[model samples]
Target chain A: MTNDASPNTQPTYYQEVERKGYSRRDFIGFVTMMTAFMGLEKSAIGQVAKALETKPRIPVIWLHFQECTCCSESFIRSSHPIVADILLDKISLDYSETLMAASGFQAEEAMKNTMTKYKGEYILCVEGSVPTGADGVYCMIGGKTSMQILEEAAAGAKAVIAWGSCASNGCVQSAKPNPTKATPIHKLLKANVPLIKVPGCPPIGEVMAGVIVHLVTFGKIPELDRVGRPKAFYSKRVHDSCYRRPFYDAGLFVETFDDENAKKGYCLYKVGCKGPSTYNACGVMKWNNGTSYPIQSGHPCIGCSEENYWDNGRLYERASAFAGFGIEANADTLGKVALAATGVAVAAHAVATNVRKKKLIFELEKEGKQSEQELKS
Target chain B: MANKYLHIHRLRRVYVWELPVRFYHWLNALVIIALIATGFYIANPLAIQSQHEASGQYTMGWIRYIHFAAAYLFFFNFLFRLYWGFVGNKYANWKQFLPISKKFFKEMWYVFRMDIMMLKGKEHMSIGHNAMAGFIYFLTFIAFLVQCLTGFGLYAPMSTWWLPKLFTWVPAVFGGDILTRQIHHWSMWFFILFAVIHVYLVFYHDYVEGRGEISSMGGGWKFIEEEVFERNHHQTPNPEN
Candidate 1:
């Protein structure tokens, strides 16, 4: 319960930026862009700038368990060099297994120092899911199970951030038949801290930066959607903001990779673009410095940001197929078979009903004729 | 035998279905047909390849609009039908749909034996839907709810409107978007199956029983033989059972 962040004692984010040799103009420009990214009105830019200038940097303990480290790679190698430098410095990131030069006991000591010094004040950013199988033997770091480490680190944190789809929703390892029993951070953490999930295979670098900045800027988690994702970034589906949306509306689509439609940049929906279902900021912000994304490069979105995306369907197939209706059966095939069977059964039933009716009528007519003849005789 | 002595000395026309009931039936049929066509198209859009600019053509957009519009109509129509079930006549009452009574099950078994098993028994007919048909329609209503839920669930993310937003939890329950879409697709097939068998049975019953089975839906009246009417009236004090 120690509040180590006495603003006078520790250097503010502004001072850190200045010490890191970034001009004041750069700091203000970054803050303005961040404010806009957070879906704030223009009036809030000054308020955010003032807060960051005086507020002490929040210490972050970034933990990695069963992950590819793509989230870490994306963060450090953000296309915008200033974002990488300032965000890296602004968080005062105390320990990251991937980025920190220290290893073994030294790295552990750095993490321990931050956890103890800023108890209940530092942010815990989990980059991967914790494998809980075999009492969490599947993923162990520094001779400690991910479950034990996550529980220990999360115990004294003020707030927790599940970094990528892996930490947020159990990305790849927790796909069907997950042997390690990989569980997302939200399910593993027993602490009652606020958890913000930034779910993507590797969420856009700027999005990751935006989430961290929003916390440090506002001193609270940004407004989240039903699934606990930041509403500003995850509110709209990629298809809603895509540049090629007109083509989708027009029913113009690329039939195949080598087709003329592909050259013309028609909508890639028919070729299995999942932009319509996947909620993320890729279409609006783009990737690689807002230059191009997967769709722009003539490839369809695999819905890496969505939960259970790996098991939804084939990466390049439409969402017509599902697991419930047999292994290879899809909507069309199943529907057609069902309709056909009904058609055949109805035809057969009609024939049987007609034959039965005809026999009954004939019998009744014969009986009536015989009765009339007997009465006349 | 009873057949030798059987005589239809009089045929009386009795009003069975009310105008509102007939209206709901026809409207539901049309709406379901439109929804299925538009739903399939949305799932896999036709590659019309408009020669004009994408901005000029709104083929997929118009189709989706029609689908959503029809969906709203379907929803409200269902609600109206549910309201009518409580307040409408005995033939149209919600009680007719539930197989709660022992006599209802007996009648269901008789209908199953005579119609499905093709047993040689006296023609079992009712002024409105038979026990078997009423039960099946009840199940279809459940499917209708599923269709509405999953349909609105998929549309929620695309819509800023509050109504569709309320159904956002549907996808999570079904696991994800693809599965929700799959369930919606499956419900369409159920309607198709129901439609096929329903039409066939209507035609078959019209020919066999000759009680105006097909025309009763359009005219809201059915011609019943006097003897058969008297027997049915005595048997069913509660017409629903």
Candidate 2:
């Protein structure tokens, strides 16, 4: 918690963060940027900056379960300093298997001490799905089941944040025909806890930081979706504000990944871009600080934000049907409907023609009778 | 003195479907068929197009135009139907459409059992649509409502202010335009499937019972047999029995 930045032989991680020429102004700017990325209104920036500047440091116990650890990788690479340094470092991350210096008993003690000392105060961030089958023997950390560890840590935590799709929705571990019976954090833990889901295969780094900052700043969990994702980040679909949306509207699309259309950056709907169905802010806030997103990088979005994304469909195949706006525009349906309309029109015309023919016959017969009478006279 | 022949009273026909109602029904049917056909093509054009390149090539664009035109008609028909449900006859009323009474469940059960029995060669007759068909009809009507809702929801993002607000719930619940479009597209299949089954069942039942059910929609009458009338013990008999 102390800023021991004396001109010494070794510059600490804190000193490197400051010595990289980040002044109080730069720090505040980062806070403002984070506020926007977190989808907080302009009014909340001041509070966020104040919280970052004043709060000593929230004690964090980052647990890695049956996961790929990509969430941790994504977190450290956050574009902003307040995210990369302050939240990750200044937050007093007491224990993390991948990032922590201590090991074995020393690491275990640090986690246990933090939980006991900062009970009901420290933040608990779970990074993977926990397997509940077979007494949780599927995943073991230091001879203890992840379920036991998770419960023990979550019981004393002030707030619980499921850091990735693995923890949030069980990811591929809980896909169809799942043998391990993997369970998400929300499902494993009792419902009353304030659980925030940051779901993605590897969630956007800034989004991960944003959730943490929002919690630290407002002293409460952010608004979440029905699936428990933070609405601030998950409220909008990637397609809503995608740069390539005009192409989708114009009906221009990339037919294949290797096609010239792909280079042209046309919409990837034809090549199985799930942007139209997936909800996430990747297209707007973007990854690695607006540098590029999946679509921008010439790859279609696989809808990692959605639940059971891995099992939705084949990655290369387009969806059988698009839902919503493009409904009546489907070519086959339109053709059939048009043909049916034509049939109806023809039927109506035929009836009209028959009526006209009957009227004409009656008039002609009357005229023929009148002419006969004239001839007789 | 015994009369050689009895004088019979002629019944006057009453107007059941008004101009607007008939127009709406026929127009909706036309448009729905167009939408479904074009939608299927759009879903997988290559499947049908493989037969003949020249014919299939020209059809897509024309079909799209027809589809959009039908969609507009469908939208208007929906609006009119919404209005008519309140102002139209007792049969067309909103109350008639919603099954809110115990009799509805009883009717539904009877219709379900009758349908099963009929499928197994047991003959049963009803004056109006049998219960299962009635329920399906009601379901199709609701599906149309959903189609309109999801359709407009997707359309709202492209359109201007007030029109979009009407479908605000679409984006609010479904995460905006793209998702709304996906929902709208997928629902067309439901409509298409319903139409195919509906037409088939109408003909199937009519043929099996010799009821002329299909022609009743066009001609508005079917000849009832004296035997059926006597069996039912009704003064007036149902034509399509």
Candidate 3:
């Protein structure tokens, strides 16, 4: 409902929130809350508050490709609806297929206006991978393939943000034998722009907010890992911060979903919880207003945040032996079989060897007796 | 001293495996078996129950501890063998592991035909490891090194020790802990295969040749025919050089 932010009356984040009926105290609370979510010290809250109150909001163009749109759902459902409202209202979000209410030509024109006005200055946020299979016929929007739209938009963006596992690592669509041949944003576009990957099945809403806050507050992307993920959220594995980690170190695990161990809140490692292998802030950040995550809800993490998770094998299977990569048996079963077969073969060989050696020994004794008798004669 | 049975003349015996080499061989065998067993339990732990507190029963924890301990033993023992190869007798020397000469290549070819192809069993005598066995052991050493790096790589994130921390970069290098773990698990199969073949061949040779092949590894001695011993004695001793 807010008017376009022109160069003259460009309001800061606080000014927009106040105009949207938020008190000054509410604005300060928001800044402090976001700072904590970003794993920053309390003192940084003042810095964030100052940044929001003084700096002009940046322009952002959100693009959707071949995806389920779960990322948008998660983003809008942050712990506080005000957080989502403030972020969207505070920024110059010119175009978003999921958020924009404008239809047809009007929406396209708005996106074109933003690209031309703020060329090489606005942020490009991509939510899914580009399906290059069949000339990317898999994902076409507004009579344009996702690939064409991405290159056109990315060409004038300052930095790109890969929103979720879909755009970051090609999620399920790029799994083995990928019919669509969906490629991730970074690989699909040769923009050579600095990419910040906020990867999760649907990333924690606060985390998405945190990245934006860091960029808006610092004028640069946060520190990233080798795979372009923020270190603050992905520095440690879920296992490291899991409430059941003590149970893991103690070797107590739930055998079955409804078993006694499961009732006792034991570790779900044996049941193929990908907590140990997956790197994400789910354990620390929690989901649904800091209420609970998948593990706490009696369900194992399917490693949705990780790359190629869909093709890694059955969700409930352990990483060590997931479908044995098509070998029906797991690593242990196959190893045991190999050992047993070798043992049987060794036994059979020993029996056959005994028979052959025994016959030769008897023949050698006969020859010795014959030679001795001949010598005596 | 009482009644003597008819006896045939057998050539004198010679020492091949030194005490240290024999010690390392059997120790390596024991450690490998332990590693394989413990490694299996660590990867696929049994569903152990504890009536009391979870801390009371450290079943999987102890299994992992045993695996790490055995892995360290295996690594150090291998290092010792490598050191011995440089200073020990000619048979255990480092040169034997390399195909540095024409004889080594010829011996390898002969073994490929005799053992693998089953074409012929023409005798090609060497007191120490045959060229093929030596080459295989060399490859096994490389596998051992890989196991050490990947194992510690997986352990690095869980431990505070400096040793494992040295390999902390390996998981990232391999893309993830799961892939590194799979590689570590697969290498165990290589050792398993090596052990089965190694034991079977020793038993087979001991039965067919009656040269005390199995006993030699235990007592550091082997028996050869008189003519064969004489020929080897009169021959030059430049095999190692």
Candidate 4:
């Protein structure tokens, strides 16, 4: 492998690719695949390929705070072999608490050394949220609060990437009545560095790699949505491109989790699937190398990619209703009100007609009585 | 004929609202009722039944058709009203809408004075619509314009060819489909509140002041002493010689 140890040595990422047993043809193929997955145009593939072949590997520091480390787990199990290897080795992943073999001060020393050596040049990847409620005592690693360590690391970083929903939006940790006051990385960091959020309970692995590749290749962050998510991935709702869209359109929904309707692969929307309102690429990208997403495995999406998936509602209860077109359950309230109003109008008209008829009959009877009285007189 | 002195208790036959204006008022009311009914249904479908039961039910489809058709009718009604504002009779013309002059200021003062005096049970009235009612009527017209614009803007995307481009500024001005839907939903509240207040004012004025305001919209004007009417109009009554 190309030794990136020397600060003066400019060994390109291509050298690392060659050392990893990937031929030129293999490197080109990886670039083509990345372009497709990243939703980049064919014209941009050459730029991506050239960057991979020439740009020096970027230095990255991955921090784990109050998290399950699922982001790391998902990253390593990416579909593309080169994605994991290239990101871990070629990208100079200097410090990760879960992946590093060092213990105690050794691990601490590695983190400090990287920050000092590559000051203002490294990327800071925060995996989870930092609790600030109680002077940041809720979560600690190696005698320092996760909040303290995060601020220290983020102080000299060029950019920050929140890897999961926990780090991006505080996830379950910051849901309603959050006791520990877990704050997202972006909110905790007061720096002017560019922040990119890849939010999901555990963001898709390929998406994680794609963010890094785009950063290295373009020398800038990808175009992001209003919420700082990459528009290329988070722009379309999961319902828009889901495989079970036909079932949703036909209104064939799964009433329960284990029902016959569910077994037939009908829409899980009625069973508390937040897919219709959530925007994520999971349905299209699929996890574990394009094998299957959560919905495909008979589990409705809990909308883990959204801001507060945990506190939004129950995972097993369908949304009451969404504000959109079509009759996707719970939209019949308006229909009922309309029908009731029509009935009331009809009843009102009927009463008015009856009253008019009674008035006419009474007048005729009074006229007859008056005529008889006049004749007798 | 009835006694001339007792004739003051009878109704008069003078045109005020005009046929075109009355037609506009009633048609708008009916269409708004239909729109709100179907709109609430389209917003959230509450009732559900088995496929067999739902199959025989054309309620949703028919409601949607009525709603959309009423929307088109409202559009044309508004168009005609706008045209008539410039070309209709003096009382129904564009001048009736503009309340920015010395005369309006004086009228506003008297209207406020009347409201203050009304606390002591002194009768306060006007031959035409009162200043506040005129202002509200103008506001209702503006509200109608907004409803038509937003409703059509939403409907355009469905047809996709011509109408969408015409009101493309709606989504851009409002933010997106989500925001537009919210505005359209909430706008219904304004119309509903206005309707309630309007009906209440009509009845309150008619019953309490004996103005026959409610019947004015149907058969036109109310009865008043000829001498008082002539004095208000700065005319000398020529008695039969």
Listed for every candidate in order, the interface RMSD values in angstroms are: 3.8, 14.0, 4.9, 10.9
**For model 4, how does the per-residue alpha-carbon lDDT over A160-218 read when each residue is reduced to its tens digit?**
99999999889988987899999889888877889999988799988888888898888
**Could you give the CAPRI-style class of model 4?**
incorrect
Better of 1 and 4 by lDDT: 1
Which segments of candidate 3 are over 4 A away from where they belong? A1-9, A319-327, A344-377, B1-27, B76-105, B116-120, B160-163, B210-212, B215-241
Candidate with best DockQ: 1
- Among all windows of 10 consecutive residues in model 1 chain A, the one with the lowest summed lDDT is A1-10
Please state the i-RMS of candidate 1.
Answer: 3.8
DockQ of each: 0.50, 0.07, 0.36, 0.09
RMSD of 2: 10.2
Fnat values, candidates in order:
0.57, 0.01, 0.35, 0.00
Better of 1 and 3 by TM-score: 1
lDDT of 3 by residue, A15-100 (tens): 77888888888888788878998899999999999998888777889999988888888888887655778776345577888888
Best-performing candidate as measured by lDDT: 1
Considering TM-score, where higher is better, how would the candidates rank from best to worst? 1, 3, 2, 4
TM-score of decoy 1:
0.92
* Model 2: per-residue Cα lDDT over A1-377, one tens digit each: 22132212223333444655678777777878889988878998887877765554567889999889999999988887657665676445888898877899988988988888778877899999999989999999888999999999999898999999999888888986778889888888863568988988899998998898888787789998666788888866787889987666545567778876777776777777887667688988788767999999988888887776765555655553222326334434554665576556545644543354444334434544555665999
lDDT at A340, model 4: 62
* Model 4 chain A worst lDDT run, 10 consecutive residues: A322-331
Which is the winner by lDDT between candidate 2 and candidate 3?
3
Clashing pairs in 3: none
DockQ of 1: 0.50
Residue-level lDDT tens digits of model 1 in B24-138: 9999999999998998898888877557888898888899999999999999999999999999988889988899998778778878888888887777456678888889999
**C-alpha lDDT values of all predictions:** 0.84, 0.69, 0.80, 0.72
